[model samples]
Target: MSMDAVTLPDLSGRTAIVTGANSGLGVETTRMLAGMGARVVMAVRDVDKGREAADAVRGETEVRWLDLADLASVRAFAKEWKGDLHLLINNAGVMAIPESRTKDGFETQFGTNHLGHFALTNLLLEHVTGRVVTVSSSLHRRAPGIEFDNVDLVGRYTPYRAYNQSKLANLLFTLELQRRLADAGSPVLAVAAHPGYAATNLQSHSGSRVQRALLAVGNRVFAQNATAGALPTIYAATQDVPGAAYAGPKNMGGQRGAPALAGRSEAAWNSVAAHRLWALSEELTGVTFPLTSSTG
Candidate 1:
């Protein structure tokens, strides 16, 4: 697919929440959504930074505090939400940082990237009238499968390995969320997208200095700008795509270009694991699918 092929409709009356909306892909996604006349809530860990970013975004926009690594913050944000949400963009995430755990004692990567959005989505599901678009990555393919027995990766921890597991969890979350929504006969869609080597600050935080240095060079030389990187997300958000559809760049083996329906690893297609993950998420977060009886 080409950039020209994916056009957005007038989103004047719609409302969207883009997490990590202070910078990079999140901010770009917020800009595009607001430019199209949607009311965008810029959810971030830092309220001040979010305000600064929101100031640059033209059209209807607001900044709200949300620390995805902390479930308390996620619950607070969801509780304050009053109206229907047209687009819930799970765009906030951490990259390959050193081994750490969330305030809730979960692996930081999985906690913020997958579990946080998992809780927020379920908490806000009743109010979501349109779609849920989670930002994933091509790195998800690196995961063998979720370390169900040792989710935190414990003694076997590695930065990239944990990152991969979290990313894979993102896709599996989408898969199960869509299945539950379908079982409930809801119109809302669940989809995932990857920025595909976007030149974003996300790479700057890699645990290895050597990796970070190399990624910095790659970002300048090969990666697409944030605008192009945010396309797959924008495409997944507004397009009439199917549930669980994965979108990413269509060129250079998904490293760059326009958004298209991208393929997933065999593990990403594992429905059983998807369900198991969903159950585990609920156990960890104390949040269940809103349409519980129907989903079961």
Candidate 2:
């Protein structure tokens, strides 16, 4: 399928929040959603960059501050949100950067990519009228499972391992969240997508210069552009996909192609791990599933 192959329903009157919407896949996703007539809030850490990106977008868009690495920032963003949210795209993330901790003293990659979104989603769950779409990566296959005993990877931390673990956590988070939503009989869905080696700035932050150089070359030679990469996410957000569905490129071993329903590793499907990870995430982030049963 081409990028245009996925026919999005008219999104007029709907509202969406796309974290990291200032650049790359987030910008492309925001453009597609807004262009389709949804009112999109570009939730970015850098408001100036967000404004610059939103200026080029052809539909309704607002730039708001959201730093997913900081729980405080996440809380502020979610607390300020008002009215119904048709989509919440957990799109912001860090790659294989130097081993660091977030403002709240958690592993940077897991903190920003998983726990931050965990807290934000729970904080905003009451206002979400539709679904939550999380962006994971095919690299998640490399991770065996969440490091529940030491999620930060502390002494065992390699940039690649940390990134892979965080991405895997994304899939598991979706799995558990969807189960909770179902158990609560909520209509909102939880799904995941991957960009499949899209050429984005995300790779430039790798702690290893050698890896960065190689990825730069790969981005030019083997990766798709951001627009193509955003397709799976757009599809996951709009289409009537099943809860816990994962979408990615359909060709080249999921490296690059049009979006399609994609498979995940066996570890990603382990409900035991998923549930345990959910418990740990709640303990770490101090956020819990907000709905006991659907209010509607």
Candidate 3:
């Protein structure tokens, strides 16, 4: 979507928590949300960094420490937070990093990108009254369905493959969560969006020099800046979108343009897979959503 396309609804009295709000898309998202008059909480791993970023923006904003890779941190943040939450933006993620594990011992990519957000959402379900906007990626379209058995990539691991798995999980999680929320007669909506190919700090952690060089070139010539990349997210959060809607750029095969309803891959449409992933997430995270007893 065009960076300037979305005209945010007045979020005057609303409150939002934007994960990884210290950099890239998170920074822009926080800025825009604050501009719209929301109490933007910039949740980042580093409190000092978060405050620094928040200071750059003009509006009511707060900084909090949240290490999504650590479940304890997630629960702690939820516990300490007060009042109704109008928005929960799950935008923090790790891309193609080397083999690693979270503090909980799960594969770094899946744990940080999917499991962490999964646990956080469930834990804070009661607090969410409006919508949950989870940031996913176009790379998910290329993934095979999630490998339930080898989620951690113990013996078999490829940076891109693992990253793709996590991104796909993000979409599936959104689908199933929306289904359950609707079934429970809840007003909370679950939405997903992708930034397409945005130039962000997400690429800085990898160790591949060749990939870095290519990305540096591509980012300047082909990719949009973080501000434009954040339009899909802003659209998803502010627009009257339906549950499970996937928003992204509508130009250049969704690489960059104005925010619109983007298409999902066939695998992303598999309800059976989404349900299975939901169950797996509950088992792995030990956090359950507030569904009917029969549903759970």
TM-score of candidate 1 against the unseen true structure: 0.97
lDDT of 3 at 117: 94
Reference-based lDDT, residue 83, model 1: 90
What ordering of candidates by lDDT runs from best to worst? 1, 2, 3
- The sequence of per-residue lDDT tens digits that candidate 3 reaches over residues 53-145 is 988999999999999999999989888988999999999999999898899999999999999999989888888999999999999988989
- Total residue pair clashes for candidate 3: 5
The sequence of per-residue lDDT tens digits that candidate 2 reaches over residues 29-133 is 999998889999999999999999999999999999999989999889988988999999999999999999999999999999999999999999999989999
Candidate 1 Cα lDDT to native: 0.94
User: Which ten contiguous residues of candidate 1 have the minimum total lDDT?
Assistant: 1-10
In candidate 1, position 293 carries an lDDT of 47
Worst 10 residues of 3 by lDDT: 1-10
Instruction: After superposing candidate 1 on the true structure, give the runs of residues whose Cα lies further than 4 Å from its correct spot.
Output: 1-3, 292-296
Candidate 1 lDDT tens digits, 18-99? 9999999999999999988999999999999899999999999999999999999999999999999999999999998999
* TM-score of each candidate structure, all chains considered together: 0.97, 0.97, 0.97
Task: Flag clash pairs in model 1.
Answer: none
